[model samples]
Target: MANNQNAELLDKARLLRHDIRDGSFTGYTSGLVPGLVQGNVVILPKVWAEDFLLYCYLNPVSCPLISMSKPGDAMVPALGADIDIRTDIPQYNVFKDGELVEQVTDIEQYWSDDMVSFVLGCSFSFEEALLRAGLSIRNIDLDRNVSMFETNIATAPSAKFFGNTVVTMRPFKPADAIRAIQITTRLPKAHGAPIHIGMPNKIGIEDLAKPEYGDSVPVNDDEIPVFWACGVTPQVAIRNAKPPLCITHVPGKMLVTDKLNDELAVL
Candidate 1:
């Protein structure tokens, strides 16, 4: 990280976070704030927060807990000094009784004194790592959100939080797939490595062209689809648990943080 480059990355992250907090930028955060970490937002009441924490512990690959806010607190000082969880996320999925009630850009109206915000590491951080390694990620190149789908693979259950895992797919040549695995394995907090590779049908995914979330990108005949455990997995579990009130970032719209992606990689 050169001094100039680091400064530029920090500037971009700051500007983007400001836009998000101000309710101006409300869209997919993929490819934005290139070298910084972006997280999946999940806000739950104190009564349900402990159970959700246990869920993250059980399904680390999909729900890797990064920075969690103190109960009844809206600020995550660990991720960023000025982050306000209530309004930092670009978009939120408001769920009631396991069903989505509405999608909103800001969650200030839903904020509660008992609410606890949990920030989970997202694949966007690792995508930048991949790009830096010279691997071509189709979704990023095409300016589209990574393709995500529900898998038959079930996540480890904890109390009321239990459901099948959800995964994001990126097509790659054999060599690139191998390199991606090597590179991503170091970032355990960012979902680690691909849960399944090559065979979508083997994992109960019926169609690649039609994904459950995000837009579909081309997967050439010679390319294999590489799947990574996604943060959205918890959203499904949250819905299953059907808490009285639940909120999560709409898929692809993340909460930008000041932490660098490289800082999260493990040897």
Candidate 2:
């Protein structure tokens, strides 16, 4: 029975990837594909890939490395059998000289022999675990992207890759927030634990409603905002690194992989 359920989930993920590839589903993938691992993407030239690799190593909590592709190789079979880094993601941000130049559904035009793609562990990979723990995820419940912000907290730098950490926020009552912390701690590959519990201002986020990326959700008066180190941190790094060319998934629209969330959990 468990095997049959897993097969069904895998089929769902493949279908979703097909829709993304065909430009049929160009939106955030937060609540969709429960139990499957989702990823954050960064595609760059071979010259810049090494530095970015070092950067991810330095900031493992914020930029946990998952599967990476060979230069000019658009396929990341380790993440999913049919993933084409250039087209499988719903949306992509094209950057030139550290500035965002365009947002597109497919990056086939930018493909080159020197381009390397990196897939990083996303917090969404652990949201299923949170749900299993009976935690109500506000963004998912509201059918919105998770709220993300650029914080004052700086990430450990490597070469030219340096920037403040970006984080995802979800508000919860105090007790539930504690439970969330415990539940998420078991998934270090998916950004293990909360970096900050409350007081958004303390982390340089002035307004919870005005996040730097993704959409904002309501926080009730009784709930406190909980912040987790986000996979989007690499975007800020890309801006600072000034790579001549870089391609990344738009903040909330992620690469849905066939890997199960439980496969990444620690005991």
TM-score of each: 0.98, 0.98
Global lDDT of each candidate? 0.91, 0.93
For model 1, the local distance difference test gives 0.91
For residue 56, give model 1's deviation from the true position in Å: 0.4
Instruction: Point out where model 1 deviates above 4 Å.
Output: none
Show where candidate 2 strays beyond 4 Å: none
How far residue 195's Cα lies from its native spot in candidate 1, in Å, is 0.9
Question: Which lDDT tens digits does candidate 2 get at residues 1-267?
Answer: 989999999999999999998889998999888999999999999998998999999999999998888888899888778888889999999999899999999999999999999999999988899898889999999999999999999999988889999999999999999999998999988999999999999999999999999898999999999999999899998899898999999988999999999898998
| Prediction 2 global C-alpha lDDT | 0.93
Give the number of the best model, judged by lDDT: 2
lDDT of 2 at 145: 94
